[model samples]
Target: MSKREMKIKPVIDRTFTDCMEQLQEGYVCAVAATAGCTVEALRRDLFGGDLLITRDGKTAHDQEVSLLLQLKNTTTVRPDPDKETFSYQLKKREYFDRLAAPRKHPKLLLVVMTTSPNQTEWTKGTHDSLEVQYCCYWRSLEGEQAADGVQKPTVRIPTRNVFDAVALTDILDRLDRGEELT
Candidate 1:
């Protein structure tokens, strides 16, 4: 990447904003930890998606394959150990269907973020403080069926769906193979 092309702060900062409540650090951490992965995230109010991540081997400047990310951050404000699965919220069926709508973008990246119930907090005690207990993960929305209602239906994300850098790469690989996210 060239010095002129070193403008990655906006993308990361936007991720931070989208992730502030859910307290998901993966939007910045995992993507940063991974190799060859770059994001072009925006702050759109409506219609357009949040983050645009390039497939592996492509930089933020490259256009080999772009995944439109619809990021959702969930939190367990009231922890429930009896809860079998986390009820993560995606957008309304109509809204999601639109992002999933056919257009110039090839793939829509559905990222489901979640964190421990009320455990993480943004540190304001000092000028430069940070939260330390937030956790998040992702899964593909490729094969899931949409809801028949107008409300933002809750999607159950099993603990098994927790995504690591390898998991993220696999999703990109599936896109490369013309396979929908499984």
Candidate 2:
């Protein structure tokens, strides 16, 4: 066989290596705030989402997996782009029902992901508590350079293009195990 024919192709692990990296960093930041230390003090690798956390800890108390909610532009079940501005409200309602609690009392993070104009429009609603934690298409999907180049804002989904349910489940499982995501 020719050298070209013998060459093996590398496969992409759509199992969420990229998104996990982003989430790990975000978790570190959140943990740092809780620890009363600069984010840099935390080791980068500590955010690997590998630490096993007990399900019964005070921090894990009343934590619901669905609180880490995600809404994306899916193939058939996507949120209505025309009604994108109201997407956050809808997600909040779903979250409330899923966790059987009010939106303000969530024990876990509330994450929302959307494409450009939708993210922009939703962000304009400054009064919305849900929009405050928004991650835009540009930051998460398009890979834009932020004003602060070192710390680019990230989107919180399993993958760049498609939302992988298996990978999401694994990540959540790790979180439920008390793994330090950051």
Candidate 3:
């Protein structure tokens, strides 16, 4: 067969979901670094969570404040009619139960949503700046009950709970003050 007659196929090892997860994790790491926090990745798929975020500087009387994060990337998150919240389905009830359970370190679900369905458009870089066309929202399922016998449960996250640098700082501050996140 001539070169023009042969079709070339590209092999892709990572799925879109995987790429989105890594991108979101990197974004979180950048924000954490800017806020003087440290982010450590847990064993992949072994624990119920992905990253552990801890405040960097610890005072004499201040206890260490850390947050366990379950990171999710989705393109099918549905916005409510009122636009106050968005609903995302948790694929595993076991994972949901783990996040809902009370623990020494508070747990949060961080869902990263892509603004565009196209993976290529998810990020753009220039000499001056890098733009990521994604937004992350956080929800604390602590002390909540998972539906009985439901393998996949849908959870609603408030629109106001954006996972930005300000939100992270606020969350860490609250935890350091011995305050629970709503």
Candidate 4:
């Protein structure tokens, strides 16, 4: 048996790890703003992880549904590599496997986000103030399993599977009939 530190050297890269939760929350908020959904950020330790989607404000008066959110962003400080490429180490695959199981009504939805691949910036207001183009993709990991015995798995999220408002709408609609997420 090896010590934890010896087995894994945790690297905290400010470029990516800094304000990470904010990036995910911001993206979800931006998306929900247009889609008429309400998002609630969950506690860090709570398994299944982050964000709960509710019905439109105008529709059910802010009633929540069965949808759990797990966000992954590709926004990093690396200068040359493609911004669309993002790698994440899933610490506890067992927990993920259980969270993504179909037996749960509120399935875990993994959202992968990235800035523009070209690294192009668009004007916000002043010419000096610019922001990178943002995009996101989502997939339901229901019934996904860990490796035969691997504890931590590094997964790569690609750009081609980018999802938009349409996909979000579909997921939200599906949750309407189920139990609300608490």
Q: Which candidate is the best by lDDT?
A: 3
Error of 4 at 97 (Å): 2.1
lDDT of 1 by residue, 1-182 (tens): 75523522332444544546434434444553574567665667354456667764455664465566666665433224466556665556765665445554457655665543223243223567444444455545544666576477566655555555776677667766666664
Ranking by lDDT: 3, 4, 1, 2
**What would the per-residue lDDT of candidate 3 be over residues 1-182, giving only the tens digit for each residue?**
64522332212334655676778888888888877888999877565788888885567776667887888876555454468887888888887888787876555655445444456767799999898777788888888887688899888888888788898999998887778887
Of candidates 3 and 1, the better by lDDT? 3
| Candidate 2: regions farther than 4 A off | 1-13, 17-21, 24-84, 88-96, 100-109, 115-182
Q: Which numbered prediction scores highest in TM-score against the true structure? A: 3
* lDDT agreement with native, every candidate: 0.54, 0.31, 0.74, 0.57
Model 2 worst lDDT window (10 residues): 136-145
**CA RMSD for every model?**
10.9, 17.6, 6.1, 7.6
User: Would you list the clashing residue pairs of candidate 1?
Assistant: 76-117
| Candidate 4, run of 10 with poorest lDDT | 116-125
* C-alpha TM-scores of all predictions: 0.61, 0.22, 0.83, 0.62
Alpha-carbon runs more than 4 Å astray in model 3:
1-14, 44-46, 58-61, 78-82, 106-108
Better of 2 and 3 by lDDT: 3
lDDT, candidate 4, 18-79, per-residue tens: 44446557767766766776777786736666787765444556656546777766543222
